[model samples]
Target: MKSILATILSIALFGGFNDIATVNELKNRAKKAYNSGDYEKALGHYIMLTDSLGVKDENITLNLANTYYKLNDTTAAINNYSNVLSSKDRSIKTVAHQQLGIINNKNKKFEEALSHFKESLKADPTNEESRYNYELLKKILEEQKKQQDQNKDQQNKDQNKDQQKNKDQEQNKDQEQNKDKQNEDQQQEDQKNKEGEQKDEKEKGEQEKKKEQGEEDEQKKEQKPEEQEGKPEEEKPANQDPSFSEKLKEMNISEEKAKMILEAMKNNEIQYYQQNKRKAKKKKDPDKPDW
Candidate 1:
């Protein structure tokens, strides 16, 4: 590194002396600014050396990549680091791969970062930092794979449980519906039986009423001999009063002497009534008291 810088500084030829001095000055400023944590200043100086001055040195490109990384510009940093990867210098390859691994790791590209770390280690077997990164990232990926498998198993178990719960709920709902239907059917059957019983009772009551009315009508027919005979009687003579035979029939008398005795009793009752009427007529009001 010293030999190359000495050779470049020693070449103070005609047209390129000023350019070479400017490039060296920019390189010194960029290095100092980066060491002092002034990434913006370092980025400006490095950009002038690499882009403006057109310095094609891989070491300068590596320095520019480092400056960009310090400025948190991972895109430009990765671009410069990738350019350094083609350098024949094993140390530069190691650094370029290590920087890419770090950038990829920061962006959570674990696989690419691990691959870069492995390449960094391959480029320089003594790079303990890259080896550490490779081992750590490998463990992290393995743990992630394990966790993913466990999560998938748990998710499957939860899905099966939910399906079984839903099935049980559906069965319970069906059972409840069936039970309600049975209760409704039973209620309808009970209602039908009750209505049938009520109808039968109503018909029985009507039959009893008809029976009672029929018995009353039979009694009335028995009392009225004409209606019992179902015909009008023949017209009689003008004397329509009860005859002696009817009287005898009323008295339940079969002998003619008993009928004569009933007639004598009737004549005596008439005489007694006439006598009582004459006594009532003789009963006069008392005379006014003599004053």
Candidate 2:
């Protein structure tokens, strides 16, 4: 630790009176060479300032890191930047920390890079680049977690929807089968009623035929010439027949006189006769009205 401190102090307080001016001149030349894309020439001049002149300035260290960075020596660049970050100079601390983090990230040392970035933020919280990098890493982690959760939710929802669809299909199938059975039952009932109506009609026709035959037998048994003659003369009429009265009885009239009157009214001459009899009754004296 003492040798390290002595080495660091030797680099800080160097040889001659014009030592800083000479180191500054070399640094300017190095910058011009680096700007002109002569990375090897710039690296040689920067190494002369840090090693030979013992001028371990933060700017010179940064230049050395830049030189190593251009040479694709990421580990050397990261080490130099880390040394700049560990210095007592508070003015360049934030920039040094941020650069160290970037180099470490370029080297694929993510945890070390993260540690450096956190130190950078602690040094200067308002550093836009460091803050952005920190927040970006945080956002990437959060997005990964959210993507995992979304995939899980989508899988669960798909499973539930499939289950619901299966249940609905089963219910629909059952309902369709029930409806088909109901239709078949209705058809069977209708066929039964139709057969019953046909059988009733057939029974009614048979009864009618039997009644007609019985009536013919009764007519054959009762046929005496005198009995037939007794049913005639007054029971029938000259222009009308007794069958008219039987036809009137079949019409469901209860009064015999009303049935005869209705039958007489159907004939034009009999209607004229009834009207004349009513007029004659009206013309007769109440006390002397003939029966």
TM-score of each: 0.53, 0.43
Best by TM-score: 1
**Residue-level lDDT tens digits of model 2 in 1-291:** 343344335445666424666666677777888999988878877877777777758878877887898898878887787777766665467777877777767777666777777888888888889888777766765787799999999999999999999999999999999999999999999999999999999999999999999999899788965445433233334227656656657976555666477566556554665666567557666787578
Clashes of 2: 0
On lDDT, the candidate that comes out on top is: 1
Per-residue lDDT of model 1, residues 115-224, tens digit only: 99999999999999999999999999999999999999999999999999999999999999999999999999999999999999999999999999999988886785
lDDT of each: 0.81, 0.74
Which pairs clash (backbone N, Cα, C closer than 3 Å) in model 2? none
Error of 2 at 72 (Å): 1.5
Tell me the deviation in Å of residue 279 in model 2.
99
10 residues in a row with least lDDT, candidate 2: 230-239
lDDT score at residue 215, model 2, on the 0-100 scale: 100
What C-alpha lDDT, on a 0 to 100 scale, does residue 188 get in candidate 2? 99
RMSD in Å for model 1: 18.0
